[model samples]
Target: MSKRRLMNTAVATAALAFLGACTSMAPKYERPAAPVAAAFPDAAASGVPSAPATDIDWQAYFADARLKQLIDIALKNNRDLRVAVLNIEAARATYQIRRADLFPTVNVGMNLQRQNYDVKELYTVGASVSGYELDLWGRVRSLSDVALANYLGTEEARKSVQMSLISQVAQLYYTMLGDEAALKVTRETLTTREDSFKLTKLKFDNGAASELDFRQSESLLENARASHALQTRLRAQDENALALLLGQGVPSDLPGGLELTGQGLVAELPAGVPSEVLARRPDVRQAEQQLIAANANIGAARAAFFPRITLTANGGTASTELSGLFKSGTGVWSFTPSITLPIFDAGRNQANLDVAKVNREIAVAQYEKAIQTAFREVADALAGRANLDEQARATAAATASEEARFKLADLRYRNGASSYLDVLDAQRSLYTAQLALVQVQTAQVQNRVALYKALGGGWTEPKAQ
Candidate 1:
């Protein structure tokens, strides 16, 4: 064959080979079975609710306007969330690089040479494709697939981070409200105790009451004062924690928040079947993406054992003088095709394949573990939902009983029908009951937040109006 005809045939052959090398050697991927129960253990037996938790936008889920504002701020400025977003960007860039490798990189070049002091300038100008791999066994494609999966995984990870941030902000905001409520109770108790202490002291001085009664009343007053101080400190700490979650200092102009008892979170969120709900979780999706990447790695490792073909080609004109570089008769072209078959590399290719298989196995295990972990979290949150509301109700009832007992005890003591110790005991009991009620209420609200998060709520934002 003539030189020109031979070059054209070779180029055509390479093009056909490139078009035919699309087979992947990776094992067929099937998602591992979820190693958990079919349904959450604490899910109600009646039926699924009208709406799944995932469908409820966080804006509508949290009734408090202040909480919605805080979540918005956290999504925008939280450092951890910011890092997650940046990671997605990095992963996308890396994927772009890998994808670029699937195509030849063409470049234009010019060279001039002078040998042995004979200033014969060989001027040349050409477009060249250097060492471009013909993906005969899908190695480059497999790597590109891996990068794409990883990029998708990072996007899911960002969603997971945002969900957690929303949950944290809501829980902490409820805690701060509970702390404020407890502080109010403590201050009220302190005031009542101070008045009681003054009355007892006057009676003791007038010989109508013993010094023991006066001392007992004074102890109650001091205990109330201590509780007030402790609650004050706790409320401040809660606010600081909330500020951190908000990614900025708590603003003074925040809209008024609902009382802890009034936080109208969706009370009866549906815990759908585990297979359905867990699949929607961003963490679980992220894990599956990672597993896909690992699977693609196996294809690349298998490809390593096959022959690799690379092509380097240049076509243009060359002349001894710069002005003749592009002349018709000065044309020159070269095509150098190289092939590398793995003869023996001390079992390195086999070892790499082994590593890839093991890594894929590890990914499978992790993916299942992610599903199991999600199952447990949702189960635990559902359990809390089933019990905390009743607990709060019982605690509130006990607090009311304690309040009435304190009133009766004080009345009896004033009528000279009972010892002052009875009144003191009743005061202590009422104060303890009040604090317990606040704690229970706080837990109840936080439990709802946890359930919402476990059900994969809060990752989605409301559409812009």
Candidate 2:
């Protein structure tokens, strides 16, 4: 058989041996414990009954067209996502490097040496060929398996990055929408106060209202106008932030303004039991893969304790006369098989083994930590979702009540049934309520995004492009 065929057969045999050993020693992976409420019993006691988390597709979940567009733009343009793609490619190259360890390394070299000698002496010229070192103890095979796991881990990590990026984009979009809604309320408040001021002034001129009424109306109008200006500024800032997320200039114009009036409800979130749940979290899975790689390294390190066998072979021709160099009579070949045993290396192999085991232990702890953290995050996000959903509803009701109170107060003041102080109080309360509603709405959307991320949403690779 050819040397290449022999090498392949040897590698196969070694791999089978290693795999058999690995199967016997490898521990079954289990996720560490985390504190999550088994039942969110009070969740429905406060707000509109929320369904249990659902594993809905992101495309269908974020119903707003503009928001979806922004998310898509961010997925394409986010610098972080781009960096993650590069990391995946780097991991792929690293995997290739490790996979190559099991195979023989072959190289071609040429030598040209010329030396002058005494007249009675003759110069000797020689040339030959060399093959490669063969892996006989499965060291390279184990290392290659470790690298493959790490590579797969990196790919999953990239997907996790993508998911997070989408969730952030969605949240920012919702924030902009909420800002625009607030801006609208501010402008409307300003217009309403201005009209009320004009009516108060007319009443004062007709000798029916006092100068105090006109002054109070004027003050309310000024405050509302100031609020409008501040809301406009805030809206501009929010737009600038969204533009940056889209990888555009901060001053880039947004085609669609925030439109929250008809914003649809979020879909349910996904819920998974603890069994192999770490597989869903990219970071946790990455940690586990590192642990696996570290485990494999132990095998590689153990193999270092055994003897290494290397075989070298060369075939060529050498002759004093250049014409005879290619003749059969000048043919030459050498085959060398050598063994290297750790007789006295001052404990280098032992130190390496210790280091590998230590690293493996560290990886194991990290993998467990990652899994615990992921579980905590998912549970916290769900609780936030439940709380924020209730808060939004309460704020909405308060806003409606405050709006009615303001209207009634204005009517009573115009009809001389109450002092202008009541109108001022009503107007202030209405503004506060509206602002609070806006905040809670924003929170609800953002928390939804967070929950989606906890459930591993948003980072799916695009198809066809």
Highest lDDT among the candidates is held by which one? 1
Clash-forming residue pairs, model 2: 53-269, 54-268, 54-269, 162-459, 163-459
Report the lDDT tens digits of candidate 2 across residue range 256-374.
54356456655355455643444566676677788888887877787787777665644455555556555655555555667788789899988988998899889878877776677
Candidate 1, superposed: residue stretches over 4 Å from native:
1-17, 45-48, 112-119
Task: Specify the highest-TM-score model's number.
Answer: 1
lDDT of 1: 0.88
Give candidate 2's TM-score.
Answer: 0.79
List the lowest-lDDT window of 10 residues for candidate 2: 120-129
lDDT score, candidate 2: 0.69
Relative to the unseen true structure, what is the C-alpha lDDT of residue 22 in candidate 2, on a scale of 0 to 100? 41
Q: What is the TM-score of each predicted model, taking all chains together?
A: 0.94, 0.79
Question: Which parts of model 2 are misplaced by more than 4 Å?
Answer: 1-57, 108-137, 199-219, 250-258, 276-278, 317-330, 344-348, 462-465
Which residue pairs show collisions in model 1? none
User: Can you give the lDDT of residue 208 in candidate 2?
Assistant: 77
Please give, for residues 73-170, the per-residue lDDT of candidate 1 as tens digits: 88888999999999999999999999888877879999988767666678888777888888878898899999999999999999999999999998
